[model samples]
Target: MDRITTQAPALVLRPWDPADAVDLVGLCQDPALRRWTNTPVDDEAGAVRWIQEQQRGRAAGHRFAFAIVESRATSSEGRLAGHMVLKNVTPGGASAEVGYWTAAHARGRGVASRALRALTDWAFTTFAGDGLARLELLHQVDNAASCRVAQKSGYELATLLPAAPPAFPRDGHLHIRSRSAQVSALVDATRR
Candidate 1:
């Protein structure tokens, strides 16, 4: 399982490791990251716990979480760039939800979109026979940046979801990309 590193054109998606606690903690310090997702890394202990949770989730075939790393020749090589996950995956189910948050330093660099597309392809391939068909990407309606990332990753707007406070405090948008989709024009825009 640890050997399951996904190679994207510009990023590497690997499982979270204990040694990444410091960087994860630092990434969580960015207010925007904290504001968008329920990050578990507030400190080193929390980071370790979060990493362990990811490990257990992976072992149980429930969640597939990855620590995004830069692989660009000119990029900050090996730097922790973001977190991405395919959650709510049910065996023999047709769909699952995807989520991610780019580190403050990694924002505006296409980190989320690249990592998302790469891992999405991985998930579809890995679960090809398990009936997995669509990966849903949801973000609060106010998160314009996430919207752009979703579009750039080939996920099209599917619907609007009403807010459920204390969890999802804002109305949200649901984007879905089917396993058979061709890379979209929005994704082509990102490629340029």
Candidate 2:
């Protein structure tokens, strides 16, 4: 698996490490996060398992999970701020879904939005040759914050999926960014 990094003005998105388990456990304890995301890091062991799963996904080329950390001048710097991932990569590699959660302390700081933008841009360019043409971000309709993040990251609201059993038990909004020729041409024509 290739290690990838994306730097933004305030944050750096990098691959997860086993050492992040401590912070991951803390993040999972946030009530807001637990409510909005299906985070499984309830204990040290769960955190370890989570990190291991992330590694497995990366090795399988099915997911790229990044730890969002604050950038500092020194090597020993800022702690874990959040996490963002591109998952559900299609067989042809043309599309993937993005998901993210911000730690309690990182809320209202634009961390999620910044990380999302950096990851989205990196994924689009870095994986273009591997058939990555589009990215999708879905959030439950009530998650206004996540919707804001998606919009801020340049994803357009595509559709509202009906409440489906098993996966989406509630109505969800799907946002998408496309690199397809048709979409590009449309964007270009609109700019002219």
Candidate 3:
């Protein structure tokens, strides 16, 4: 698959490149980032492997992972601000899971929520003809910031999920944002 480059008012989201391994390693260094999500990127080698996984996932059309950067970035090489992915998509599937994380430098600045909105918009636009109906975003119960991001992205809390030990160590919230709901919310947001 060709690389995807998406944009929002404040962001430019492109495919994860091997060149971003250094930035990934640095972003993964934040304890809060590590504690909130599980991506297994602790070092440069891990970062490279993770990036390859993203590439492979894209090739397989099972996931679309994006490296988020500022649209008007200061550096020639846009500083990596965050990451987002639409994972677990099956061919002509009705739903897909979305996940994201923001670097410490970008936290509390609406990066996650805005990038997620961009990704969600892209997913629905790109996959709707394939029967995509909704996006699911899950996060551990303790992740208040994540919960906020979900809400801001117009995903409503749908259900509670039990902890799956070793993988999901805590109870989680499953949020759902359907295409109809997203359209309404987006229209409302634009109106406001």
Candidate 4:
């Protein structure tokens, strides 16, 4: 497993830990987040479980979850700004789905977009050996903010998926980003 630690000018993307459970609880309490994700992290135990589940998923090669931390100089430095993940990874790593949520305070600061971009870059660069070829992001049809994030992260709106069972039980938009030709060329050059 790759220990991913990607940094941007304003944020850092690292693995989520047990120490982040408290912050996760608070983030889950935000009504807007709840409405979007339908997560079960309303309390400490749930938050712990969330962290544990992410670890398990990573160990199983099913997902890679990250904590979005801001690079600040104040006491709140390193606070949990949000969560981002590459989930529903297919066997053989041909593709994966990206998902994210911003904490209430991080909502308008472009945290989600920046972290997502960093995560996408890392995934493409690190997972080519595992056969990763593309990544996808999906959001409810009415989620304009998420749409903007997808666009900012270089994912193109591919299609509209009708309300389906389980994960997306509502109409949604699918966004996709394939491993770019430049990256593929670079990989080939390195191989030679």
Candidate 5:
């Protein structure tokens, strides 16, 4: 494992690296990520492209993505357990939306919750000097796990933004969860 970045009791969240392409490909291949996020690469070339784009996105400051690494009882340090990507970030920017997926082998172990909390905390403070007001998670209403993550991350149900599904066979309903006064309260309560 590389040096721990955003450390909690058992996990570390750090920026994505170009060298992480292979593991990232494997991470994206998890069925859960495929169902919720954009499709994973089917070939090495595609994975390479995705990794390059992520690197570019990071350099351009248009988006930020991090790997969620965790320590296991058997491992001395931490290992990449998942990924978290935050898009459209700017100080006092209208809003930043977060997306994440846990590794297939690391699900249901509080990894997502811990990472989300850390990410949200960073988002909240990143724009404190500016007028940045809130963060949001635009989730498909049917994705209960993500809804839980959003809730745990200090977002409250703000509104529903409706749309059509990509395949056109299904209706798309987008639920928007926003960080508001309640989130401030959550921050106060959770901050040590």
Candidate 6:
């Protein structure tokens, strides 16, 4: 399947573009975002490279990286809120990993949670035919806030990956949300 576009009340997730470099750099400046995630707002050059990589990833079909942005802003004045990506998508495509962050100012407003839910819904719905079995979230163990977000989004803690993966700076929580479970939970919520 091709990359998808997801929208929520506060934000829209679209394919990343080169023009997003400036706002993306600003969003990555939050130390909290950088410390736990690989996102670094080092320089314009870095942003340029990231934009290029997003394009390359899309072309290669290994990833889908979106530019999380506000819905109301004109493109020229729109802020780069952050990003959400679905990576390591399988040939069966039923499984994928999600990662996301919001700008420092956007924290606590449920942006990340909403974005995660939106993406999860899309992933399960759109990729179900591809054996889309499950989706997972990875977060540092000390990041209680993120853990809460995952819980709120209906992901259950699956394991404590003892060793930090090469890309992770430290050991963390590995949470999983299976498609059938997610659908059942959503159905239950709507019935109440």
Winner by TM-score:
3
Prediction 6 TM-score vs. true: 0.88
In lDDT terms, how accurate is model 4?
0.83
TM-score of each: 0.88, 0.87, 0.91, 0.87, 0.79, 0.88
Pairs of colliding residues, candidate 4: none
- Badly placed stretches (over 4 Å) of model 5 are 1-9, 72-77, 165-183, 190-192
lDDT tens per residue, model 2, 35-125: 7887778899999999999989988888899888887767634888898999987566788898999998888878888788777777777
Model 5: per-residue Cα lDDT at residue 169: 26
| Candidates ranked, most accurate by lDDT first | 3, 1, 4, 2, 6, 5
How far off is residue 100 in model 3, in Å? 0.5
Per-residue C-alpha lDDT of model 1 across residues 1-192, encoded as one tens digit per residue = 342344444677888889999999999988898889988678999999999999898888979898888776676347888988988888899999899999998899777887888778788878878989889998999999999999998899999999999789999999999976833534766889
Candidates in order have lDDT scores of 0.85, 0.82, 0.87, 0.83, 0.68, 0.79
Using lDDT as the yardstick, the better of models 1 and 6 is 1
Following a full C-alpha superposition, what root-mean-square deviation does model 6 have from the true structure? 2.6
* lDDT, candidate 6, 94-147, per-residue tens: 678998878887788787888788788877887787898899899988899889
Query: How many clashing pairs does model 2 include?
Result: 0
Q: List the residue pairs that clash in candidate 1.
A: none
How high is the lDDT of residue 143 in model 4? 92
Candidate 3 vs candidate 4, TM-score winner: 3
Per-residue error at 149 for model 1, in Å?
A: 0.3
